[model samples]
Target: MTKRRIFMAGAMSGLLLPSIHAQTGTNTRIRNLRVLCGFPPGGATDAVSRRVSDKLQGSYADVSLVDNRPGAAGRIAIDELKRSKPDGSTMLLTPAAVITLFPHIYEGINYKTDDFTPTSTACQVQFGFGVGPGVPSSVTDINSYLRWAKANSGAASYGSPATGSLPHILGVLLANQSRVALNHIPYKGSAPGMSDLLGGQVPAFSGLLGDWLPHIKTGKARLLATSGKERSALTPNVPTFAELGFKDLVMSEWYGFFLPKGATKETANAAADAIAKAVRQKDVIDAFAQLGLEASASTPTELGIRMKEEFRLWETTVQKLGIKIEI
Candidate 1:
């Protein structure tokens, strides 16, 4: 049988396809493909996954779907993905947080870095620090914000989607570097924290730029600085944290594709090529750019290296901050 046929059968049966001993001399035609994500339907992860999935569907003459399996800060979805068949048909599209941060913060996670093989990275989502308009800090830059917060008597309050998340670690890192005290308030997700920020219940929040862009434009919130090293093309006037004197504050949240571990190299490469082609389309690039996310693609090896680096970074940060959970 052809490699594609073998992969499809293995996907349906939840079994691994043995390595092809010789070249098939024919390209594999993908049939049904599922890309799993670990966030709610309307969140950033879901949005990007759907965008990529739509483009792939149009490019490939095959069935493609983006599945949402949000829970446990993405551990639930990761667990399910790990259990999936090691076939190209079943894959995952998840944020770096799920692989790099979640495993470090939470206990009893169902999967680890070894559970999957990298496919290709899709895009980089920029994060920013935003505050409600009511704050009188007059902090248009990161340095000034730190100065103003340190001068204040009480700990400055900030919000994040969850404890030990990228934003949370960034907040702590910023506080440590600036010698300022920040009171971190954790929320279940970005929606609730954003709600509190708009309602004047919280002074500031750190999250995806798209999540707070509307509020910033409406005068309900003011963006202080972004974590991305360079200013975003969509909001070039907004300075990066490095530009404002916080040199170590640069970071971007990445999203990428993964297949269940043990998939044949040829199957993984085919899937990655399909995804890279989909992401390269002008329509897909335009859609992601509109959300302040830059479109980029990486080989499986490159993604694997990135995951390892991010894992090390998160482990160090979590240990330093004493961030932990009871599972």
Candidate 2:
């Protein structure tokens, strides 16, 4: 298998730091910058946006805030972003799935990948499949869980942070490959879905590794497998889906920034520079690590390339799955 290049905050600093410059405005500071998050507050997307928003204050703008437009599996924020000004005052920090996977899976999606200009990527996260108390203790690993699900098809259901998300796709892929009857439950965000996972409202869940880490540590959830090319360092004992015989499932999701279409390259560069600087900070890096994300930065051009690559990759995968969703 080919290895994926992992960008680090430190490695990108030398390339991006020199690009940071002051944008011309009142008192040399932009006022009331808003970073939009598609998911509700307290989820991974919101956390990354809030952290970067704090760093953006004083330098990028006089005030920075996270605008939570949570709905329609993150499409709400995308629509809101399309209507936002292209002056760099507003930015969207969202999962790559909304750009890469949505167009493939969703019907009547109003926004296109080109509707927004790529700014910078905040971080990348791996997905994990976890089981809660609702699952039988006898089901320990992916194979056992699949067997249990097959035996109890009526009760076989999994929750994902949102519909048509990478986690949701991963769940569907697993069921298709294993020939198991597993239904999917979509949530507004990880917090509410995770609550049900611990409380046994759903027997299984596929979501970001961060969503399950705390519960797993507290013995409230059991991680079955991760979706990555290699084993996750945080859960070394937990095998990856590839290691568990699902080679096609190796994938990861990233949180990236984007400005609405019609934004100038200079404006995009300024936002990118601020985001690169912010994501590389020691505090930001440590905080992201706790959330099972690898904090990193990228040039706007680099982000655009990565986004296209991901879009193509998900296009092929979604085509193979033959899944199209409405809304």
lDDT of 2 at 307: 92
Position 203, candidate 2: lDDT: 96
Q: Model 1: which residue pairs collide? A: none
Cα error of candidate 2 at position 107, Å = 2.1
lDDT of 1 at 123: 91
- Candidate 2 least-lDDT 10 residues: 8-17
Q: What digit string (tens of lDDT, one per residue) describes model 1 on residues 1-327?
A: 111111111122233233222234635555666778777677778888988888776444266677676666676566667777775667789989889887877766656788889989999988888787546647666666666677764747899987767888788888888878999998878889999988778878988887766777777888888888788876788898898888988988889999888988787777778889988989888888767678889888899899989989888878887877644
lDDT of 2 at 63: 74
Model 1 alpha-carbon miss at residue 7, Å:
30
C-alpha lDDT of residue 44 in model 1: 75
The local distance difference test score of model 1 is 0.77
Per-residue C-alpha lDDT of model 2 across residues 121-183, encoded as one tens digit per residue: 999989999899999998889999999998898999999977778889899989988889899
Lowest summed lDDT over 10 consecutive residues: which window, candidate 1? 1-10
